[model samples]
Target: MQPLILHIPHASTHIPFKDGYLVGEELLQQEINKLTDWYTDDLFDSPEDITIKADFSRIFCDVERFVDDQQEVMAQYGMGMLYTHTDAGQRMREVNPTLRKQIKEEYYLPHHQKLEVAVKKQLDQFGHALMVDCHSFTDIPFERDLNKKVPRPDINIGTDPFHTSQTLQDLTLEFFTSRGFSVGLNWPYSGTMVPMAYYQKNRQVQSILIEVNRKLYLDAVTCTRNRHFNEIKSVLNQYLHLIRSNVNDIFYPINNES
Candidate 1:
């Protein structure tokens, strides 16, 4: 088996509210459901791969954002590592510098650390690691989104020039496009995830961010899986198998057999 890491960062809905920090549990639940990737973890999960998922909601701690505000594009909207605004531009919670530091040390750092450890293990074992960041977005835009007016495609593939090569990008695009899904290079969202320590240093780590349109498999209003869920899941399973079959060539070409 080749080294593959399935990174599911936003499927969780659990929020630690015992500190009496949140306003209302009901509203929090709704917000979480709206912001979450829904059933993405289940959609991309493979029994043969190593999967690392966040245990809490992004509202509490977004492990995907760059730790530094200046480096994170979404920081301008107050949705950086620690979110201070809601999807509608309202105050989600007041997290001061001290509190933000606490959240990062407790949740953010550890989560990324887990990913780092996984990637390093893969690197040691196979000389490279393929990190597939799985996600799902609502068909319609949220109120505070910068590109709210723009239409989102069925599948948005986020890439990094350093980690995502043309071959991998083309293959991924073709795979989903051939499946009848409207694919976008980067529309509503862009960029891929890499561990902080290896951000610009490691070319052995290949990253791809996949954003599935919620309309494809979800009941938008109720936030539940629809009939299309199984079909999409099967499609994802096929893609995972394809990746496993071609891992060396697609990701680690240096190791490809002559």
Candidate 2:
């Protein structure tokens, strides 16, 4: 068991649309800059053996969402499995059922399948898997964001009632706060990622979403890492160490002394 599986769903600016459904290249780049979790993948680095990253941008296909619209809440906002609107609540492109289905099959399903495989492999070997859902948000919330009015903290830890363990949650909060980060629990964003099959059924599949606010380490205007980039990454490395060291204590008490 690798003990940790980092699930980085965003951070790619590559939008592979050769047809040019978007109005202009400038608009596309604006949307990408606004929506992409810029430099988050680098910030959330760790020595985890299992990592499932989506190389394609979320604007193309959001793998974290439920494939079925009825089950996905973000579908109402036109930002479900396949985005129908931009972050500013404007039309990005028209996605018909056929296109939606194609995107789902091509990008969405494959990323999730990889995640499922990684998680199951860990569970089979160690009887437990700790999934760290990595993400980052802008300091200013987008127009389409549900919690636009809420002031997001420097570090937001999203958790699911079913899959997030209390011990892991406590350690996570402590780790970030001790480093002088203002932490929020599911404020700007809620819901942690768990493979749909084991989502509500398996308690051994522990998961947590660590959302770092971009203002801390990213130059929002230029879409680049600031001087604080390495500082934040170093702190995250320490945080990972803490979580890894206590894996036995938190998830496998029987092997605490082993």
Candidate 3:
């Protein structure tokens, strides 16, 4: 069946957050592993909240790492500051350029591109479609705030920063707000790397990348399921329903009144 709404949860770089050997991501993974089960069976499942594994692997620790353990430097290789090593202007030498390219092609690009093409295909079948990129981030301060782990806003709305319809944005804000979620606008996150379709304004479809603060349902240090996981999940299911019902109005203003 064609899908009117598409969600692209940005494919993670497999870099676990760590301090030295283990990065901060390891802590976060603990939380996700509880729910997703370490990429086992289904992409995600809730079958009895079963057992999972947590072995150490630096592979999931960084995306474009240029150094190895014991400070062995990788020879220079790649492009500008964007895709290059942590050191600005330094190409990650000796690092398999082919593998890095494959990571982007196989992991990141294809995943999102597939969603885009899927949305386009569906747009032809249906009148309108929307893509909402779902993501999560720690609400903890960058300066290592181990204390105030309070869950941030219940909802964050981004309408491509007023590039999309302001009416639609306002309506979206109201939609979430009415459902008893505390909403935030462009706070903690606005948007990043959201490619624009050549015919965005003309097309009868819409795409918005929405990032959720991960701290909502996971503890800051342990990354384990917090008390609010189910509560937040319940809200999201309803939010999806609201957006689907109201989407047509965003494109056809006449239909909104009718």
Better of 1 and 2 by TM-score: 2
Could you give candidate 3's per-residue lDDT for residues 1-258 as a string of tens digits? 223343423233243222222224444344334322122111222232221222222233221222232231332222221122222222222334554464545444544455556656656777555555454545543222223334567555655642355556777788777877676676555542233452335344555544455656666555456787777666655555556566666667633633
Q: Candidate 2's residue-wise lDDT over 1-258, tens digit each? A: 355889998888877663425557788788888888887778877656467899998877788888888998989887888877777677777877788777778778888899999988888988888888999998898887878755679998999987877788899999888888999898888889999879888888888999999999999889989999999999887887788888866676423523
Candidate 3, superposed: residue stretches over 4 Å from native: 11-96, 143-152, 161-163, 192-203, 254-258
What's the lDDT for residue 35 in model 3?
23
lDDT of each: 0.83, 0.83, 0.44
The candidate that achieves the highest TM-score relative to the unseen native structure: 2
TM-score of each: 0.93, 0.94, 0.59
What are the runs in model 1 whose C-alpha is more than 4 Å off?
Answer: 18-22, 252-258
Arrange candidates by lDDT, descending.
1, 2, 3
Residue 58 local lDDT, model 3: 23
